[model samples]
Target: MIAWPPKAAPRIQPIGAERSAECAAIHAASFLHPWQEADFEQLFVGPGTVADGAIEEKEERLAGFIISRIAADEAEILTLAVAPNWRRRGVATQLLAPHLAALAVNRASSIFLEVEAENAAALALYANFGFEKVGERKSYYRAAGAEPKPALVMRRVLL
Candidate 1:
């Protein structure tokens, strides 16, 4: 989730309902429990939803994407995913920087997200960006053959 940016800078672009298929593809490839294309499409058109994708300029492919929902002065990051090939290359950092600014512009004073408790890289990245430990959701992530990792809810003051 905290993938560093690579040598080539990714171009950040608004992702609308039309790109739900591509978003679903990345989500399926990245998560154990992936949200479907319909889910992405719904979110894309949902009230207060904001979505963006990081595109690799070199290949003209999506490197990663982030989606969030804003309600009043608060916001929550729905998902942040990086393509397998783009992991550890800093796409998350690049995507989040501009996204946070947009949230502030939208008058969001605080933002939140949930991540696996064991995801050190993501925790570190969030911490670096001023997010703090908030609450936890037990067994938030589960697999058919594996134990679940608790989800840590983190919050950051954006404005």
Candidate 2:
């Protein structure tokens, strides 16, 4: 008989103010302009905000996080970041699946987010989740000493 390895099952939980530092760290490592701890603290307690983290159970560390804010029937994803050591290993997928369900429960009819035009990996991930490009923002993102980059505005309707 052959033995197969068990699939990875990441634990998903609501991120609180205490973990704002950790989330900030991950965001800094993943993005050019990352939100600070204070920003995360507010989002954690904000009425329309949802913050979720993916935990690596054995190590007891955050693998990734996703944050979004909903207003009325619409939701907008603020950011999705994964720890450097956890990228390309399905952490984003695990984080997004439950996050989407949570958004639906919060009465979001559709979700919107913007991804840098050159971020092929993120674009692919969003596309896999059925997000379609609705518009583009010229020079929507800027970096120090570099030319600004465009961002794609994407939307996905919930069931």
Candidate 3:
């Protein structure tokens, strides 16, 4: 029998205001435009929204996280990020598993998300998971003070 390497244990836990700072910092570092900590705080507290967070652990540090929400038979991937030190190690797959399963169970026939056209890695990841382009929202995001960037809308059918 081939001996498999030990896997790092990850925990999917509900996020609170306490970790908003770390989450925001990681979110900012991982994306061209990041949401403020206040935004996350509101998400966690906002009514009619369901969000879950995961922390990939090694010793005691947070390796990465993924956040999402389900609404009326549909779920949007609000954010999916892995810490720079922990990329390409299956952290994202683990984090997304629960949310995706739950969304499917909630009658989410299709899920949609928007990504920047220049973010090849993210686009590839979504495409690899069977998401297809459904539309485009031009100039959807801006880099702080720069001109807006085009957003590519993608969707995946689950049911």
Q: Tell me the whole-model lDDT of each prediction, alpha carbons only.
A: 0.89, 0.90, 0.73
TM for every model, in the order presented, reads 0.91, 0.93, 0.81
Best by TM-score: 2
Off by over 4 Å in 3: 1-9, 13-16, 144-147
The parts of candidate 2 lying over 4 Å away from their true place are 1-8
Instruction: After superposing candidate 1 on the true structure, give the runs of residues whose Cα lies further than 4 Å from its correct spot.
Output: 1-7
Predicted candidate 1: what Cα RMSD to the true structure?
2.6
- As for TM-score, the candidate ahead, 1 or 2, is 2
Candidate 3 clash figure, as a count: 0
lDDT per residue as tens, model 2, 1-159: 212344356699888788899999999999999899998998889889987899888877888999999999999999999898777778788889989999999999999999999999899999989999999999999999999999999999996
Judging by lDDT against the true structure, name the best candidate.
2
Each model's Cα RMSD: 2.6, 3.6, 4.0
Residue lDDT tens for model 1, 39-116: 998999999998889988887788899999999999999999988877887788888999999889899999999999
Residue 144 Cα positional deviation in candidate 2, in Å, after optimal superposition? 1.2
Comparison by lDDT, 1 against 2, better one: 2
Error at 10, model 1, angstroms: 1.3
- Residue pairs clashing, model 3: none
User: Any residue pairs clashing in model 1, and if so which?
Assistant: 3-90, 4-89, 4-90, 5-89, 5-90
